[model samples]
Target: MKETPSANKSPPKDDPRIDALIRGYAHLSEQVEVLTEQVKIQKHQVDDLTVDAILAEFHQKQERKTHADSPTPYGRTPPEPAEKEEAPKHLQPEKPHRKRQGLKLAGNIVFYSALVFLIISALFIRTTSNGSPRSLAGFTGMVVLSGSMQAEIPKGSLVIAQQVDPKTLQIGDDITFMANPTTTVTHRIIGIIEDYEDTGQRAFQTQGIMNDEPDAQPVPAVNVVGKVIFHSEVLGQIAGFMGQYWLFILFAAAVVIGLTVILKRIYQKEPKQTAH
Candidate 1:
């Protein structure tokens, strides 16, 4: 008797091509998952940094309040005179020793110099890269003031902007202009309304992606600054932090960079000669 079709059927043999395709698909899926996770992590990090920067800026603008959390300083807050009380004989007061402060002062000076140098270096790099002159050319770096751009350019991020000829700009390009008469704004030029270019001065208007209304009035071309080309979350955070207590931040950063350089030099200079 012949074997029935059902009995004759066996499991299909695995093909090399089919196996390879399956493995490839699995690998691609894993890669996509990993990339997704990395993106999520980076976004979260940027958000946290931005928040910290904003808070730091706010604190700097406001004066420190004297409260339960704040300790009173110096003779500003006079201590109440103690009522007539007997001095404890068991608690003998010891003579105060003169503290050696010169070493610390010297160390602080070196640290401060290093920090200043690092900041200057960073600023120079930024200026050179952004096409801004290093002197007092009325050019300044602006932090992404708001989150209108969101994912493309989040708030609390630093951007280098230089004043430029507005006539050189084209549609769909990002530009910075004054929004109200008082506030400076940075936004993409969605459209350009050509108007009379009287006296070689062209007026341009600006709008934000997240905004419904166009800017109240057109800004003069002179108000247009250089285009933003660079942005960094780290820089934004640092700027925000420094905005609060600039002196403290400057001093701290200098000390950190100075120590780092000194340590690096020491490590590199150590001889690697073999011991007998």
Candidate 2:
């Protein structure tokens, strides 16, 4: 029997699927090239960051050592170093294992700077109320001045509240509301009430958890700011103190500058130690 001519026939010359596949593969190759370049750039950024971390750690360690060796304002020298029993080589603090003090300080500085910026912006920059905070996304931060909500939402706490519907607020939910022209209060909604004074406005009876009795008047729904979602106590205290006292800001700023200067001196001194 004769073998069929089409048995081993080559693919069709005008196969659209093959042409499309080839184009797709080419596009994929281009994407891969772009992605590889991106990865390389990212890798360099990561390397730079790692080096920064290492240098920061080094500076911090040196700062501690320098301070330990520093003389007092009266020219009194620091305490002499006490000789210590040598630990095994593996027990020593490794480069990668050292504390990330520099990074931590940087983070703190950024955090506080942003907090201060937000507070100042809300109070001074915005065209709204005299001291009303500028909202970011749906959240607003307020510095608690009164001690009514002590311990839980302590005085000087930065209460970061998120906007929520008044009707959705349940009893025991901590809420921030404008009590009067001069003050805003962050208290729990103890009971739902009517706003007889403001006909259209809803109201709720609010109280501080630490207070013996609930507030005498109801919080008008129109005055409800938001529900307390989170709070930053430590940062808030620093901000409050600095804000309340103008001179404290200068002192705090000076301290930070002094610390940076000391660290820079220590970093420069590192080369001399290495040579010795």
- Which model scores highest in lDDT? 2
Q: Which stretches of candidate 1 lie over 4 Å from their true place?
A: 1-139, 180-182, 193-197, 257-276
Model 1, 119: alpha-carbon shift in Å? 1.8
Would you list the C-alpha lDDT of every candidate in the order shown?
0.66, 0.76
Residue 246 Cα positional deviation in candidate 1, in Å, after optimal superposition? 2.5
lDDT per residue, candidate 1, 19-117, as tens digits? 888999999999999999999999999999999999998875453332323566666663443356766867755434413466656877987676664
Cα lDDT tens digits, model 2, 1-276, are 996777778789898989999999999999999999999999999999999999999997786678776654567565557578988999977665345776777887996686566445334312236545556777767788778888798787888778898878889899988777646789999998655565855789999988999998988887887899987778686656555554555566557667877997998888554553
| Model 1 lDDT-worst window of ten | 127-136
* TM-scores for the candidates: 0.43, 0.44
